[model samples]
Structures are given as structure tokens and as C-alpha cells.
Target: MKYNKKAMTKLINQHRELHDELKKIKVEMGLEKNLAIKTLFHSMVADNGPYMKEYQELERMQ
Candidate 1:
């Protein structure tokens, strides 16, 4: 299947935005605090799973 460049670029941009948001959340929650960081990391992972999975699938297809 042919992939649409514009759509793919948008998806990639969204992924980057999510990554940056995660970083900000981590910093805001206190990265030096192990407990809070761990909790936030888990939550972020769970929240980003779908997007990450979709990105991986698309990567494989390409």
C-alpha cells in the first residue's frame, strides 16, 4: 500500500509533540523524585501505547 507523505508527516509530528509533553509532565512532577517519576512514566507509557503501536505498524509496512 502506498503511504501518504503528508499524513505520515503529521502523524510523526504528533508523536514528537506527545514525547515533548511527556517530558514536560515528568519535569513538572519532579524527575528527581523516584516514586513520582515512576508513576508518571507508567502512566505516560500506558497513554502513549496506542500511538506508539500505530507508528511501529506503519514503520513496518513501509
Candidate 2:
């Protein structure tokens, strides 16, 4: 099977934007200070870290 690399790249970018927006909201609303909440937020951000690798590989391809 084949895929459109540009479309995939755009999708990844959109997801990253959404991620950042959510992170911003958490900060703006002061939700990151609680220990449990901060841990969760950090974990969520860590999960997104791997996507950066995938996005880089895709960008290198097309």
C-alpha cells in the first residue's frame, strides 16, 4: 500500500498543534501545579515525543 506523505505530514502537524493548544490551556488555567496532574501532563507530553521521530522520518522521505 502507498500513502500521500504530504497529507500525513500535515496530519501530524495538526496533531502537534492540538497538543500544544491543550498544553497551553492547562497552563493558562493553572492545572499543572497539582502533583498528579503535572505527572499526567508530563506523561502525555512524553507520549507525543515519539511522533517527532516519525514526523522527521516522513519529512526526510518527501
Candidate 3:
């Protein structure tokens, strides 16, 4: 299937924005020293890591 370039670019940009927000949250959690929440967050990120890498590859291709 064909994809719309502009739409895909916008989608990726939004994905990057969301990822940045996640990083910000990580810092906030670290500051709070919330061990349990930090452990859960790390697990969630690890599970999603593959998909995140794929998106990054796509961005590089563009």
C-alpha cells in the first residue's frame, strides 16, 4: 500500500515528541526516587524497545 509522505512525517514527529515526554517523566521519577514505578517504567520501555527501534529506522530512511 502507498503511504502519504506528509502524514507519515507528521506521525513520526509526534512519536518523537511523545518519546521526549517519556524521557522527561523518567527524570521526574528519578528525582522522586520512586523505585517501584521506575522498575515498571523500565520494563514497559524494554518491551516497546523493538518497535521504537523500528520507528527510528524508518525515520532514518526518510
Candidate 4:
């Protein structure tokens, strides 16, 4: 299916917003200031960072 430019722009913006929110959540969980949270986030990023496309696709459907 072809999406119009405006729809694509909106989807991109939504994806960015989700990413920023996740970053904020990670920071607020003390990941940036605590060792354990940092380790968890690091491991998660290493193992699943590339799966964000699935999350983005799901988010777009909402």
C-alpha cells in the first residue's frame, strides 16, 4: 500500500516520539545513574535493539 507523504511523516514523528519516551523511561528508571539498571538496559539494547521495527509497526497501527 502506498502511503501519502503526510501519513509517512506522521508515522515517522510517532516513531521518534516513542523512542524519546522510551529513553526518558530508561533514564527515570535510574538506568543512567544506577549500575543495575544500566546493565539491564545495556543487555537489552545489545540483544533486542534492532527489534524496534516491530514495536514501531505496532505503534503505527494504533
Candidate 5:
């Protein structure tokens, strides 16, 4: 498999930023007691997990 180093670096950085933002939202979600918003954030956090893992895998490819 071929990979572009610069592009991968950009992707990895973006992923880190996104993950950080998601974590902040998750923290905020913890303070939320509303059932609907909590449910949405739960799903959003779940969806982000796999993508973060994928980004980690890509970043590890050298």
C-alpha cells in the first residue's frame, strides 16, 4: 500500500483535533441530564471511536 506522508500527517493531526473536540463534547454531555441530547452525544461518541482507530492505524503505517 502506498501512502503520502504529508497528507497522512495532515489527516493524523485533523483526527487528533477532532478527537479532542469530541472528548470535550463528551465531557459536556456528562453535565447534561436531558435524555435526548445525552443519547445523541452517546451515538456521536460511539461513531467517532472507530474513525479515531482508523486514523491511528493509518498514522502507524510507515
Candidate 6:
């Protein structure tokens, strides 16, 4: 399947932005004692980081 380069670039950028925001939120919420929220955000940050990396790699290969 072929992808539009412009659209892929935009998608990668959006993913990058979301990954960054999630990291920031995780840091800002560091002092919170809510284990559930912290765990959820931690997982989200972890997942997003890898996904963004994969997306960037795919974009580069395009």
C-alpha cells in the first residue's frame, strides 16, 4: 500500500506531539500519589514513545 507523503508527515508529527505531551503530563503528575492514574499514564507514555519511534522510522523509509 502506498501512503501520501504529506499525510504521513502530518501523522508522524501529531504522534510526536502526543508522545511529548504524554511525557510532560507524566512528569507533572510525578508527585501525585494516585497509583492508578500514574500507572495508566506510565503505560501510555511507554506505549506512545515506541509508537512514535516506529512512525518516525516508517516516515523515513518512505
Q: Residue 24's C-alpha lDDT in candidate 6?
A: 64
Q: Give the range of the ten consecutive residues with the poorest summed lDDT in model 4.
A: 1-10
**Per-residue alpha-carbon lDDT of candidate 3 for residues 6-55, written as tens digits (9 for 90 to 100):** 43334435566544644566686664324433433344323464334544
The number of the candidate with the highest TM-score is 1
* lDDT of candidate model 2 versus the reference: 0.47
**Residue-level lDDT tens digits of model 2 in 1-55:** 1233463435335576545655565677766524433333344333464344544
Give RMSD (Å) of candidate 6 vs. truth: 10.8
TM-score, model 2 to reference = 0.27
Stretches of candidate 1 off by over 4 Å are: 1-14, 32-41, 44-52, 55-62
Candidate 5 wrongly placed segments (more than 4 Å):
1-14, 31-62
For all predictions, the C-alpha RMSD in Å is: 9.4, 10.4, 10.6, 10.8, 10.6, 10.8
Candidate 5 colliding pairs, count:
0
lDDT of 1 at 36: 39
**lDDT at residue 61 of model 3 (Cα atoms):** 68
Q: Model 2 has how many clashing residue pairs?
A: 0
Which should have the higher lDDT, number 4 or number 5? 5
Q: Which residue runs of candidate 3 sit more than 4 Å off their true CA positions?
A: 1-14, 31-62
Encode model 5's per-residue lDDT on 1-62: one tens digit a residue. 23334433444356665446545655866644234333433443334643445545655664
TM-score of each: 0.32, 0.27, 0.27, 0.28, 0.27, 0.28
lDDT of 1: 0.49
Cα displacement (angstroms), candidate 6, residue 9, comes to 18
CA lDDT for candidate 6: 0.47
